[model samples]
Target: MSLVKKFATVASGTLMSRVLGFTREMLMAAALGTGPVADAFYAAFQFPNTFRRLFAEGAFNTAFVPLFAKEIEAGGIDGARRFSEEVFGVLFSVLIALTIVMELAMPLLVRTIIAPGFAGDPQKYGLTVALATIMFPYLMCMSLAAMMAGMLNSLRRYFAAAIAPVFLNVILIAVLGHAWYKGADGLSVGYAMAWGVMAAGVVQLAIVWIAARHAGISIGFKRPRLTPNVKRLLWLALPAAITGGITQINTLIGTAIASTQASAVSSLALADRVYQLPLGVVGIAVAIVLLPELSRALKAGNLVEAASLQNRSVEFTLFLTLPAAAALLAISEPIVRLLYERGEFAASGATSTVSAILAIFGLGLPAFVLIKAFTPGYFAREDTKTPMVFAAISVAVNIATALMLFPRMGAPGIAVASAIAGWVNALMLLAVLVRRGHWGHDAPLMRRIPRLVLSSALMGGALYGGAIWLAPWLASSAPVLSQATALALLCGAGALLYFVLAFATGGTDIAMIRRNIRRGQAAAASMEE
Candidate 1:
């Protein structure tokens, strides 16, 4: 498939998942709000999820896909199947063991990691431990799911993997809604949500398993073996795991700092959920789809194509991410109020927390996207260690900044620390890439980046002005309609301003974009034929 078509397939599925995810979060906010129950739940949720990203999605995918792709290229489909089987066996063993350990250690882990949040409140602490224990095994299920997703990605079947996340949101929404109807505490909803997470992992695994079967690359477990292929995978996975762990250390730091704050640290997590919607849809989708393709291109000595693809993906990421960052920064209060100010959640608290964190996180949105775009360069080369080193530095910076800033800035300080660390990570990656000559600014990038910056600045300015002008109306009586109208107008005006500036400053290559879209459509049609 053409790159654009491949991107579209992944992007469309991701967009769908993100939309459902938004609905899920909205329901969660209404049902749970920003209370102690929500705090405990979000904290509990982050534990399994943090590790899942580290082991399954981040490290495993990076290490597994390139090797799987290589096996296919070198020895055809059968060899790749054997390789996958061996790797799966090893991965399954490790994850199962890890999950068991985590389940057993749940209380201790929560005590150490988020002690402050739980220290003053015994009930909250107990609930967090209990929920975390139930959710800990989700790491195993999702790790298996990731293995399945890697297989599908290796076969260039992007749809199933991308769509799997939607099921997760659906299940959570259903559980939360059911719990709400029963008048269960939000903590009950949280436990339900935890089980929903495990259930979603199973469904996701099944979806990708079916896709792999359809592609004639399915495998089942056999007697465990540490074959040479398995050994090689483990070796590759070690550095990848370390790299993923380092990246997540920043998040761990942020969580730790947020825990030390007041009763609503997890509400910051709720606001983060809002910003992560766009980040996950655009940044992660591009990263997952682009990585294996880049790996294959590099392995096949197609450097030019790899470079072109990287450039295009970066352009696409910046084009979308900048506008999203602007919108979040400008309209965070209204967005938060609209989505979360009902049921048990107070409008004032939600507005304050959301506005603060949104502004802080918006500062780093482009850098986050850039990190995703640039890391593929190293992963494609199977040099995960380099990124690990930089990631460690970024983590240290993140932790220190959070420690220093949190006393002064509270929950928002943690967000700022994370964002600044992202910038640090991005800069380090870019510097190394330039030094190695793996990624240098091409004429197009050199010409377009300034324009992109200018366009984003214009959009941010317009959004700020628009938000101020509409603030009174948004804060007035008839809040729902007035707030919605204000948000829509501000977003519309900002979008128009961005487009106008982009077009005038040559930030957008309209002709190229249309040509790429047409080519993608033609490719899809030919595949159907």
Candidate 2:
């Protein structure tokens, strides 16, 4: 398969998961609103997710996939299996200990790192501790799953790992639906959501485990030991884990600061969910696929191919994210209102707040995606230390900016801080990569980026006007069908116009995309052989 095809496989799965995630969020908004339970629950939920990203998605995958791919290249599937089992044994043991420790220390963690602002409120603090403890074990399941996912991705089996997240949303949505049907209170819904998260983790892990088994790797238990490969992985993983932790620290800081304000935590989360759709679909797809591909190229001493891969990945990222950012900025208010301004989420206040945050996040969308494209340039070459330094700097900037703005601008201020930090990290990564002569924009990327920007700008203007024209139908008092239709039309028209403009302005060429696809497929075929 070509790069585009691989991207599609991952993106399609991500798109489904994101859409279901939106549905789950919508139900949460209806059932819990931006109330205390919602705040408590979101804060609690973020605890395990923070660790999952830090350990599994960020640290583990970054270090594991490249090494796993090398193992396959050098010693074949049997070699890879031995390496995986070794890592898994150690990983499993570590996770079990971590979970036990976290469960016991839940209250202290809630009051300190998780959501210090909740400390004053006895009910919120207690509830956050309880919920976090229930969900913390999810970290173990997802961590093991990440190990399996690394195996799958190295084998060019992207769909199972990419699609696994949908179960989380699916399970949560069902929980919310059941609770809503029973007219459960916000507290009841929150508890149900926590349990649902735990169950989803198990389900997701099972899915990937089965997929890996089918792929000819059935990881089994072994006593933990630091084999040479396991030790090397741990060595590489330490800096990567720190880098990932720094990124999450930015989020933790935002949450802690936002927790001081009423409804700010939930509002920021809702806004995050909106922007995450594009980020997950485009950025994550690029990150997951690019790392292994680049590693293979570099490992084979194919410098030119590695450079092309990075440039095209960056191009592909901008091509998709630019228009997404445009749409988010264009219709943020209407989008938020249509999606969440029902039940506990009031149009009068929460919608505007969330919309503003969403728009701010949009401004940073491309930068966020670019980070995904750029990091593989470093990680593929086994240079985790550089990115870790950059991540620390970015976190510092985020902390300083968020602290400076939160007192004045509140939740949106945190979003602004995040966007600024994203740009800082992305620019630093790109600068260093260019300086090291590790990546550069080729002719197509150079020529097409300007056109993509122009196309997105034009689309943004059209979307803005369309949103205004459809205001009546998009209003809070409008029929749900009318609102849905209006939103869909605006999105459809914006997308159509963007593509048309992209083609007309020579921003994106049909012929070039086809060539890249062919090149990607040819590359994949050669790797397989």
Candidate 3:
């Protein structure tokens, strides 16, 4: 499909998954509150998710997809299948070994890596270990699913892989419902949720597996071997994983520091949920499609088209991310309060604190999305190490700033540190691409970015004013309906104002968008064949 249409397709599924995830977080906030069990579970949950982000979504896909796409383009199905099977075998064995090792080292892992603070409370510490053990198996499932997703994306079949994540939220939400129905205690609920996480991974893996088969691609289990192709993949994937993994590693650092506090882990987790909506819908959709597009274009020696695709994707990234960031910066507290303040978190809630973190994330949203848009410029050309070096610098910056600020600003401090790192990472990546003569900006993109920033600023102002006007409705004792209504109106006003201002300022190019949309069918057939 056309890049825009492929983005929309992936984004639609991502939107669904993100919405479901938001619901699940709301449910979790209600069920777990800001308690010890909640803290333990979130910390433990971070373990598997960190690896999932590292191996599945981050490193593995970033490394594997471009290579896989090139193979398919150059050698066709048989060539691609042989490579995929070898990597699958190695991936499966490594994951199984990793799972077993993690299980055996559960206590030490929990004590040192996952939740050191829980060590003070035997009950909490023991439970976290148990839950992490149950969830550790999820890493194995999701890594395989991620490989399947990479294959699908390379094949231009993004819907299934994008949709697969929704089942995770669905299962977790159902588990949360069951917990409430059963009047389960905090730890009991936490345990069940952990199990639900593993179950969801299994189901996600199955769905993607079936989808891959339907797409005329299947890599069944085989005994592990170190073939030449597998060795090449490993050489590519290891560094790719590290570069892709830096963000998650930063998150791990933040969570580890947060774990030392009573309520910091839960607060950070909820804030992450709020910000991930835009990041997932906009950033991930572009990331999923951009690599293959760039890889294919560059392979055909279409340097001009490759540069254009990157520019256009970067253009869209800013277009969508600015409004999303403005809206969040404007209405974060109210949105968080409306969505999360109920059951255990009640009236006043932890919403304000989490909102602070969300706003910090807003400051960095453009940088984060731009990083995704830019990195493919490097990765598609097999230049993973440059990004990895830049990523390592970002991670060190994040860690140093996080440690310095955590003592003063708590979780919000951590968020700001990460945002700073994002800007550093993005600017450096952009500079590298420019220096290497790979990324070039067109007149339209160069002309519009400043206008986009101004439009976002205007929207932020409108949101601030609306937030003030809707103060009563957003207050603690306000009816949930009133709060929800006010938040909705506030968001609508901000979005409407952003679009009007953006267009008036010559910041947006709607005419180009329509033409791109028209080309989807032809693009789809070309990619599939």
Best by lDDT: 2
Q: Who wins the TM-score comparison? A: 2
For residues 41-149, what per-residue lDDT tens digits would candidate 1 score against the true structure?
A: 8788888888888888887678888888889889989999988888787778877888888788878888888545576678888988988887787788888888888
Candidate 1: residue 318 Cα off by (Å): 1.1
Q: Number of clashes in every candidate structure?
A: 0, 0, 2
Better of 1 and 3 by TM-score: 3
Model 1 weakest lDDT span, ten residues long:
519-528
Task: Estimate the overall C-alpha local distance difference test score of candidate 2.
Answer: 0.90
Cα lDDT of candidate 1 equals 0.79
Q: After superposition, how far is residue 157 of candidate 3 from its true place, in Å?
A: 0.5
lDDT of 3 by residue, 384-463 (tens): 88998998999999999999999999999999999999999999999989888897758888999999999999999889
lDDT against the true structure, each candidate: 0.79, 0.90, 0.87
Error of 3 at 387 (Å): 0.6
- Model 1 residue runs over 4 Å out of place are 114-116, 242-247, 515-529
* Model 2 Cα lDDT, one tens digit per residue, 305-340: 898888888889998999999999999999998889
Better by lDDT, candidate 2 or 1: 2
TM-score of each: 0.94, 0.98, 0.97
